[model samples]
Target: MNAAYAQSSVTLYGVIDPDIVFVNNAQTGRSGGQLTGKQQYSMLDGTTSAYFGSRFGFRGVEDLGGGMSAIFTLENGFNAANGTLGQGGLLFGRQAFVGLSSASTGRVTLGRQYSSLWDFVSPLAIITQWAGYIGSHPDDLDNIGGTNRENSSVKYTTPVWNGVSADAMYSMGGVSGNFAQNQVWSVGVGYTGGPVRLGVAFVDAFDPNISMFGATATAGGVTTNNLGSLGSATTAQRNPVIAGYASAHRQQIFGAGGSYAIGHATLGVVYTNTRFVGLGGNSGPNPFGYSGSSTITNVEANVGYQVAPAVTLGAAYTFTKDDGPNNQGARYQQVTAGAHYLLSKRTDIYMVAAYQRASGTNSLGQAAVASVAGLTPSARNQQVVDTIGIAHRF
Candidate 1:
């Protein structure tokens, strides 16, 4: 390059993860054929192991003088297996935001960004660390895995104050006449002191189908029409755990979690509650004919040990329960184990396995089926997955 900027700097960063996976008791033939139960073996691009997803991006910072700076990030998520875009094909779907920061104050940003839960509480969740995608809390009902993002939003984060920090976000509903039709808001707080880390967060969305899960490439890109069909708004998700409740008039999530580190080993635990209220005809077909509300509660505990300088082992167990209208209840239990070996500073090899069992009535008002996030739903009440992968960053 010929140009030079003295007070500005930009850096390029990316991660690529590819894995071979095995799934059992999965349903197949969704493209117009007899859907049958079968075992599947395939290669996945990213988001299964090592990292959340395969992505590349440019992040830059410009000194504005007096300990202030202008900052921005543009990230793109892509499938390493097929070389296609992830996150609904948006060029910078993973994250795209610009903001100003101050050393004494905080920072404010606008554009597509993460929710406070994603920023604060998610880090303490096992699914975000080593539990893998399949280890998500029964379809990631509370979004602790950050399966969704907020669009057309403004976010504020506070500078750490005596081992504590906080953030908040608000997303515009964008409806001309209905100011709260699809609006979303969230808040979170975190604390870090010595070997202890703690976090808590809460999020509420009006018409979550449109304001949250609907913000995808195939889902019409974050609309304000609460009257739209839920199926159309949540086409990106196949997990039935919460899909049936997408048409709910409101959705709320609360999560609190923390981790404690002792030498080379760490122990973590998290609890989350998610609610879908006012389920009725505001959207499309109510498959289960749900008329009232539904609630899901989850708890997870995990431990990780650094066996060696370059080797780590982790395991987690999660329990989830759902209570819906008409006294329907579903329950799920899962266990996950994984190990990662660092080949180099920027590359690693990993193996992970997870198994889950389900019972009772699911949100669809049918027999509960095991459905791990990022994989096909099981034909029965039990499912298993194993993955071997390699991840690299640059």
Candidate 2:
């Protein structure tokens, strides 16, 4: 082991991933208007997070003696194609945390970081670690709805014993009057031995709401305002915030996953269930009283085979089903396959293809909302995307 500042070390690490992509049934413009209909198209890349999501980070560790050490990491996510922050313009959108660790005790960290759900289950699901196009759930429901990464959080991890370990985290709301609003909590355990690894976790989110508009009006036969609609209705519903208070809502997530290695092949499987319940009155347009409950279940599987010391072939699939009040139920499925060739231990090239299909009833029963341009209730739509990219880590 390297000693503290006596042997202090600082390293710069980053990955620059950019990919060219082809999509079928892609809307043309950012406006929901019908600029271009379903057709094959090609682009510079990053359909999902822009290939490698260019990022730079600094990580270091210092020995504090007596079996204790101090560690820190500061990472930022950016769009390589456009040179911009990745997560809603947050500077350290990916992660920013500092912590202390003990060889005999455990580790404690604080800051914006990935939640237990992602830390535990994502490894088993090829999509989360790779990209949204392949492993992502329909609309990223599994990852985001369960609070993929949190802000203002404190986390703890137990020292591994015989390949078994545990972790827990709690997030502060940062709100004055309401202590629980927008807070989050999570706990998990994992075990890895020989050729098998398994983990389980649970997470809860107080309130989280985000939105994105469609590019075109009728790419998947669903018509909506070119700028996308916002409200407490339909799939765009968000938790309501009090007049002078913060939003009040809650989410619970439970997941389990495992992976096994066999010869030169590895296989992984994961299952997650998330529940959301509204706590406040409708802040946006309350077409159906606003307060509602929803549950989402996700299952994913992956397989990877090492073709050579520097090459790997993999395939993955994910299924998601949403059930809720006000005709908000929907089903989403995705299939992905890809391959990677390592240029070195810290660099690689990859090619991946993905297909997504969605079927369900619209939240608005009448389907007459101007946002949805004559979109039929309970329709099925599909999208196909292919990507080729390279990533390097240092």
Candidate 3:
């Protein structure tokens, strides 16, 4: 490992990922009007972190000898397509933290960072790693996509032992009076052995209305979708897949995933359970009429193959089920395919496609329609999306 950094090391790193995408169906309607089942064909990218966030960062390490060291990282998320800051325009929206490490012990860090849950399950999930947020579960309700980071947090990671390691984290809500108002806690563990990797993770958030949806208790909740309105395709940001579920007062998630490598091929699968608690209160002005709580289960299976030294191919399938009030549930199914070609060690290009269909009552008790993880929810029950992009890291 380079003999404990013979010299102090500071490095600059970042990724620029931009894509042009098209959608078959993009939902739109007048405010509080009716649903206008519409189809959209336009150029789209992660203007709102749609997938594989584009970011840049600076990190450094100072070796103290005796198997000890100090480290720090400052990263920023941005819109590579338009040269703008992301993550609510924070200077270091992606991450900002410092910590100490001991070769024989572990590491302890403080600042803004991704939850332990993310460190665990992301590697085994297709959307989180390759497809980016576009493949996230409905609404990214599972955090397999949006807001994957936390602020005012402390984290710990145990030294790897026999290919096994564990991590835990806690985020202080920063509320003066209500200490627990927006607090969050997470834990994860993983094992990486030859040709195989396995992991499981969990997270709980208090006062999810603001923590997840970026709204206050009074102003929290999703806006009412048009009942039956339609619109012509334009350059409008699509709605979240499960917008109505935003009213959830609290959020909880549990997930497990694993990958196995076989020769030139790797196979993986992941399962996640996400829930929104006490929706009645946080539901925005036009709540989804859901009382009590709601739950969603997502299951995915995928395969990756190295067709050549610098070329790869992948395919995947996902199944989602929503358990809403009174046992009225909805169902969604999706198929995905992609191709990636490496231009160099730090640069590559890709093309991806996904199709989805939905049925049953949605989060707001309306007819369910297809919604891809990254694109807008569809007015009808089916939607398709395709994108071509290039990513460069330095």
Best of the candidates, TM-score: 1
Tens digits of per-residue lDDT, candidate 2, 243-360, equal 1111125567788999999999988988989765672422122333435666778888888888999887888777777664544566667787887788998777788777766666
Give the better candidate number (1 or 2) by lDDT. 1
lDDT of 1 by residue, 72-175 (tens): 99999888989998877889988999999997999999989999998888888777787557667887788888878888999999999999999999999999
Q: Against the true structure, candidate 1 has what lDDT?
A: 0.81
For candidate 1, list the clashing residue pairs, or say none: none
**How many clashes show up per model?**
0, 9, 11
Q: For model 3, where is the 10-residue window of minimal lDDT?
A: 217-226
User: Over 4 Å off in model 2, which ranges?
Assistant: 1-7, 28-52, 128-133, 144-148, 210-248, 279-288, 362-380
> lDDT of each prediction vs. the true structure?
0.81, 0.59, 0.74
Global Cα lDDT for candidate 3: 0.74
Each prediction's TM-score versus the true structure: 0.92, 0.80, 0.88
Q: For this target, which candidate reaches the highest lDDT against the unseen true structure?
A: 1
lDDT digits (tens) for residues 1-394 of candidate 3 = 5664455789998888888878877766544444554666654444222147788899999887789889999998887767877776778978899999897899999998888667988778777556777677765668776455777899999999999999999989888898778788899999999999999999998766565544531121234432223233232223434556655667898999999999999999999998878776643432445668888899999998899999988888999988875567788898888888889988888888888888887765667777776566776788888888888888
